[model samples]
Target: TATGWAQGGIAAAIGADDAPSLHAADTEAAGAGLTDPAVALRVAAEGPRLIDWLVSLGAPFDRDADGALALGLEAAHGRRRIVRAGGDSTGGRVLETLVRAVFATPSIEVVTASVHDLLQDENGAAAGVVCERDGARFRIRARAVVLATGGVGALYASTTNPRGATGRGLALAARAGAVMRDLEFVQFHPTAIAVGADPMPLATEALRGEGARLVDETGAAVMAGIAGGDLAPRDVVARGIFQALARGRTVYLDTRGALGASMPTRFPTVAGLCATAGIDPARQAIPVRPAAHYHMGGIRVDGTCASSVPGLYANGEVASTGLHGANRLASNSLLEALAFSGFIADAFDAMPPAAVLPEIRTARASSDLPAIRAIMERHVGVVRDAAGLQIAVDGLSRLAETGCDAALTALMMAQAALGRCESRGGHWRSDHPHAAPARHTEATLRSPGAAPSEPARTDEALAR
Candidate 1:
């Protein structure tokens, strides 16, 4: 199973007073109009059903004494409908349970291997993934390939993703001539634990839902000036933290009075991590700052999770299914992944299998891992502009000129980051501060045979 360092609960319209329409509207607003209205409507409508399915599969979401699902409000939502597994430890708890269920299922096989490249047939249809594990290489051929390998958060210097989230799937898909979308829009979590750990552990946003306040070192409220304050949109909050850091002030999320004695009962993971770090949230404020958390852009896919290439499907963080748009609402990433996984699974199972054919020859290529990671961290990081993006594009292009498969992935991210023009969501361009006229720009890198005329800046075309 794939792993993520996600800390937020899955958002849904499960609250008694919440409706899918309201949730969809909130999502669209948070997505800044780049959201696909139809996708938003569909996901929101299916929210409750998906939640019910997850619960039935033994997700064990937290519930009140009356057996009603407990909900929490995250940064971007109109209602408190985020279903938690155990307070702020929702992602861990849910994934652990799902992993157990998946392991128990007889038909499913879990392989612990890292996929290096795609295995394609003579007709250019995807057949399987070439992977390596413990010094052994193997090809796991299947009728359909699902890219649930998560996001590129690790491309940044500081991120909240597992170390494996190096945009491998994004690069792999790109090299296979599959179209990628919106690779530029990255969502930085506003409040990662700032005690100076690499890939800094997170301080869940649900703390804010429990009434934690964002304060400066002087014990004064820092979010009073913003519209939503502590509950503002993620981008706004991240920028706020950035500004605070720029001024050399320590920013903190005061959870002392907010959570207090009930902290362990609500967020055991957070409590344990804090304790390990010599902190007591019930008694002191926790230092925090922004860190790369999610990628709003990824491999472009249709409504059914079909990529540009035949027989290749992508879901979860790897696929840009147009549900999250420019900025993903808090907790929606997990929901999107689950929803698309279901869609891809059902769709793949229903398709008739192609006749067995001879396997295509596979190739191994060199990778400049350090160079690609450095380039992504520098240019496509928290704050971006034209110059840095161009530098990133140039650097990746130089790497790709070496004819390595891994370099091609870096090239894809660089190209897409360069193409997106406006400062929408987490892709804040210093040159363009305001949101441009409403547009849904999907980040796409051009194939050799594709059009080369400035990448066609049209609604139908990909962003790059």
Candidate 2:
């Protein structure tokens, strides 16, 4: 579960001095002008209630000395509005809480299997899914299908996401003729622990909020000439670290001066991770580098979490609701998922009965992941240029023709990155280096390996 790997807490305006509007302002500021104000406001207003809902399910969130919820701070947030659990083990604890609640419910059944494809009715609406479990293929027909399969960080060689984060849901949506929006906006965390590990360990952004610094060898500040120094928006910090590494400088997250001896209790997750890498935060600066962390782009969905496909829905990292826009605000990922879950439920309940499911055979081909990862890491990484992006699009297109879902998703991402022709938020183009007009990128697959001629653009928020 990628949620279990999240060390930062959920952002919510629960403080007495804070309001949802203030929270929305900070979100919009971090979003680089693409975040929908209404979406931000609605999600912000849902924060306190969502926290309450989690508490009712025994989430065991951390509390201050007064027994109220302990609120921490993160980058780009103006207030101490991050609600956490067990210090830095918020995601693990929350996952445990939800699992317990889910098991307690009688209507749910937990299945361990891989969904290979979606089944559609005669009218082209989603109706079911094809599943494979223990070497046996089967089908489970349903009225609707909701994809929550997470982000595409695993497409890159260096990432903090689990290996399974390969954009499975995005591929599923695209193959079903659903719109994908801003597939280029991949967020790279500036502080992935660089100790020669695959799927690198993350040093949460909250560490910087607690006064950590980004320094290179000889204690030179890596972000010295940059605005906001070590506490800038994620994209700025990532570029700083990336450019520093490109110049043969070894970057480090100097937490020795910040948390130090209190690291174990304050951030035991990162402390334990550092120990495995043979680093002692109390005595040494932690070596770090930028790595793919999250995706602000996904299947285009409306306010109700409904996709262009009539009976297909999306939530969490799988759906683009125009909240994150060009970049996602720190700690807002978990909050967005929580707020949208209710909207998805309401949409599902009001839907008409599903049409008869048509019998459709589905098959999946093994992907050459090493080849795909190498292309993405070299061409479409933290920094991008037209020549490299064109190379990526060409390479990925050939793999997509082989019926590789991972490759199709990567090709879409590369196409979107190439078409944008400007640096904005997560999609930085070294050739362009500056943003043009602000507009959302919309695309859909007409056929496998077929690229859109030009991406559609809209300056306003996606339709509600």
Backbone collision tally, model 2: 0
Q: At residue 157, give the lDDT of candidate 2.
A: 95
Q: Tally clashing residue pairs in candidate 1.
A: 4
Error of 1 at 331 (Å): 0.8
What are the per-residue Cα lDDT tens digits for candidate 2 across 221-299? 9999888889899999999999999999999998884486788898999999999988999789999999999999999
Model 1 alpha-carbon drift over 4 Å, by segment: 1-4, 354-374, 402-407, 442-464
TM-score of each predicted structure versus truth: 0.90, 0.95
- Residue 104 lDDT in candidate 2: 96
